[model samples]
Target: MAKLKSLMSCAANRLQQASGLDQTEARIEIRALMQHSLGGVNHAWLIAHGDDTVTDALRVRFESLLARRIQGEPVAHILGRREFYGRDFAVTPDTLIPRPDTEILVETALDRIPPDQACEILDMGTGTGAIGITLALERPHAQVTILDYSEAALAIARENARQLSAHNVAALHSDWFSAVQGQRFDLIVSNPPYVEADDPHLQQGDLRFEPITALASGTDGLDDIRRIVAHAPMHLKPSGWLIIEHGYNQGEAVRSIFSGHYFANVHTVQDLAGHDRVTLGQLT
Candidate 1:
């Protein structure tokens, strides 16, 4: 009978040795696995239960999860949930895992749309409905619609909205602006595929398990961004905002695309890491 603390230590050591993850990340991953197996308990619970004996069945389950982590499967995918914008969003292989950087896009959108305003918001390429659902929940008066190209992705987004009880959110299946023809919105936001087709990072770590269509854009990784910037103006009302989350190094190119399209107030904002992550423009 292994103790909980010993099991966690051994698992963290195995992950650090086999997955090339540093000690801190390995520990974090081990803690996440423990939390998953222990009924979503927090780290404090783990600390309090460190002396508890691990049953054979539970140990086997934890080991299985550890094996998946060693295989480069994302902890979010393994646990089936990811916390974003102070909420836990359901996740699956069908959709991109909701990332912390995307919260910036949500925050920016919330800042733009006032709480009392009853407006329409569109979240293009919404995977897991994190952005649109967050907006809807944050501003209950706003009518939020999230569109995805993949039906599987749309299903996950819809289920997330249902689970979160976000009544203001609606999920639709569309490739970009195709399905929303003639429907103008007060705000349009997306965290589209912005990674280069051949980017080396795609072959590494968690990206290996994520859907390629949700990550890679084009040769320079600006294909989807360009398409969105070109088409969003038509779907956005005059003075409406279009906010997009892109690769860290894509600020200049994205801003240029916005400028070429004659968008007003075009600008790029950095994430918590000081890397440019989101770019926005207004259709004037």
Candidate 2:
């Protein structure tokens, strides 16, 4: 049997060659695969136990995962979980993997919700329940409703909410606002499908493994955004806030939509990449 350190180094090299990832990212993937296969080990533990011998059984398990990744299955899907805003959210093929960029949506929503107030928040198209669950945890007093059209995706989100003990969050199935009917909320946020149907990125990288219905919109990728903006006023309470994450190049168009709807203080916020990622406005 090979030493654990040597086995890990070989796996990282194979991952790097297959995925074109840098040495740092390759090592991270190796660490995640190692932990998943070996069990009971974290990054710190792996570093401390590098000299441990790799048993034949453990080597088989580790290589199986690495091979799957090399063949293009998403790392999150393979691991059955994803980390978002310091919480581990269970994810599957039915649900889009929670992304780091969406954390900006949660942070912006946090600014709108008070720590002590019993605010009503809506998370539309919620997948993995990351945004809603994180907000519910952060503001224990706030009630968050997470809505999704896909029952399978909703199952994953509900499970995540349960595991995270987000008691203030409720999961509902709806094709948009159909289930809410006459109800309204003080705040509504979403990370809806903003990728153009023909966008080449959909066929590349981890995107290839994600559900297309959760990623692609209309030809220009503004179909869902337009529908959400048009219908949001109906559900938002007086002075309620509406925030939505969109494609980077869509800042101008989204801002214009909000303005046309007579929303107040309409503007766009850049992500860590400095791309216009989230746009928000208050109900007039």
TM-score against truth, every candidate: 0.97, 0.98
lDDT for model 2: 0.93
- The residue-by-residue lDDT of candidate 2 on 11-56, one tens digit each, is 8999999999999989998899999997747888888989999898
Enumerate residue pairs that collide in model 1.
Answer: none
Off by over 4 Å in 2: none
Candidate 1 TM-score, C-alpha based: 0.97
lDDT of 1 by residue, 156-236 (tens): 999999999999988888999999999999999999999999999999989988999999989999999999999888899
By TM-score, who's the top model here? 2
Q: What's model 1's overall lDDT?
A: 0.93
What is candidate 2's TM-score against the reference? Answer: 0.98
